[model samples]
Target: MAEVGDDVYREDPTARRLEERVAEITGKEAALFVPSGTMGNQIALLCHTQRGDEVVVGEGAHCAYYESGAGAAWSGVQFEVAGRGGLFTAAELEAVIKAPAYYMPRTRVVALENTHNRAGGVVFPEDEVHAIAQVARAHGLAMHLDGARLWNASVATGRAVAALAAPFDTVSVCFSKGLGAPVGSALCGSAETIAAALRFRKMLGGGMRQIGVLAAAALYALDHHVERLFEDHAAAKVIAAALRDVAGAWVPAPETNLVMVDTPGIPAARFVEAAERRGVRVSAFGPHRTRICTHLDLPREEVLRVAEVLVEALREANAEASAGMGAGTSAGTVG
Candidate 1:
């Protein structure tokens, strides 16, 4: 095991190296290594906005719905939801930007997600990001990217991460989510922004002593794991196609390594349980929806196996529901 070094004082070589590499990749002036994606995002928000300010975010974004309202709880900032299903047009953003005369909370930042999770891993088109960035600039709002799956988007679109990050004031990238790193996230931004965020990070109890061991894994992933993302995306597509043909289910075309499937007639929990029984693990996001994610450790063959398990699971659930309906019909007749 690697020795723990005090990271709070900036003496951790591994953390420092990871931060530098993140800044280089994103073409930012500086970077800070954080413990998790949520912390990176919250710290970035804290750096950019005053208390009581608001951020414009997609309704389905991870920060808005998944981060447990930490932005408001920690920073006293609220969200102005932009659109449904994580899709927001530049015009929609323009309309939502707050005017100075209004007593409403000022929209200090526009936050976006790449490979939006709730949107079936949809890649927010590069042109769209640029357009939204332009809108943010026009309104003097800071732009932040919840780029947890940015590497997936970059691989799918063949766009450089730096080019994609250019329009935003800050971006948070995760190494653990899909990159196979055990733990780590990087927040990249201008020197001033990172300096400001570091203070907030310490305040939030994110200061570490020595994190080079984790940083080492992140460094390894950035160099060797990035290109392999295409394999994950391809596997997700295969899984989605397989699920689409299953009874009582519909899977959208995958844009990255996430596939969202709807079990129209079967309860989501039942579907998940069935899949788990067959040795495939997935998450139920809603009453009728499940999400499957592909990652570095998941091999292509395993992905196919998951698909097979999913198909069988759906079939089993549908059959059970049909049998129950038949039982109810017979009972009614007997009654």
Candidate 2:
């Protein structure tokens, strides 16, 4: 592992190196390392806005629905949800900027998630980002990006991560997600913004000492693992194609490493249980939709195995349902 001195005092050489690299990649003046992507994004919000402020975010954004309301609790900022699929047009944002009304909280930040989680990991187009940034600038609102899966977006779209991040005032990127590092996230921004974020990080109990070990892993991933995300994307599309042929299975066209399959006419929990029994693991997202993620840890053989097990599980479920109906029953349980 790379070695560095204590980081709580900001002397860790490896951490500094990683921060500097992240800043260069994002075209930011500075960067700070945080424990997780959520922490990185939340710290940025806390540092950028005061209490009683509002942050505009997509309805399906991780910060809006999945971060356990940290923006509200830690930053004392309210969320103004934009749209169902976590997409907002520039016109939409312009309309939402509050007038000079004392009753409404001022919208201080506009946050977006690239490769939107609930939208089947859809990558937001760069033009949309630029337009929204223009609106944010006109309103004096800072823009932040929850770029946890940004590397995947870059690989899938053939766009540099910096190009996507350039329009935002701050961006949080993760190494543990698609990058396959064990842990670490970097928040990149202007020097003053990062200086303020470092303080908020300390207040949020995110300060660490001698964190070069984790930083080293993150650095390694950024160097060696980013280019291979295209393979994961290809694997996801393969899984989606396989699921499309399975009876009672619905798979959306995948854009990244995530594949969302809808097991219609079959309970998703049962599908997951059956898949696990076959030594393939998957998680149910809703009553019908289940999410399967392809990662560096999961090899191509494992991906194929998952697809085979899903097909078998679906076949068994359909047969069981058919047998039950033939026997004049509603449905039958499969062991």
The whole-model lDDT of each prediction reads 0.85, 0.85
TM-score (all chains, Cα) for each model: 0.94, 0.93
In angstroms, the error of model 2 at 190 is: 0.3
In terms of TM-score, the best-performing candidate is: 1
In terms of lDDT, the poorest run of 10 residues in model 2 is: 326-335
* Model 2 lDDT per residue over 1-335, tens place: 68888999999999999999999998899999999988998998987899999999886788877788898898899988775677888988887788868898989999999988777788988898999999899889999999999998999999999998999889999999898899989999999999999998999899999999999999999999999998899889888898899877878899999888776676666666667788777776666667778888888777787777778876776676556533221221110
What would the per-residue lDDT of candidate 1 be over residues 23-72, giving only the tens digit for each residue?
Answer: 99999999999899999999988888889899999877888777778988
Steric clash count of candidate 2: 0
**Error at 286, model 1, angstroms:** 0.3
Q: List the residue pairs that clash in candidate 1.
A: 5-209, 5-210, 6-209, 7-208, 7-209, 7-210, 8-208
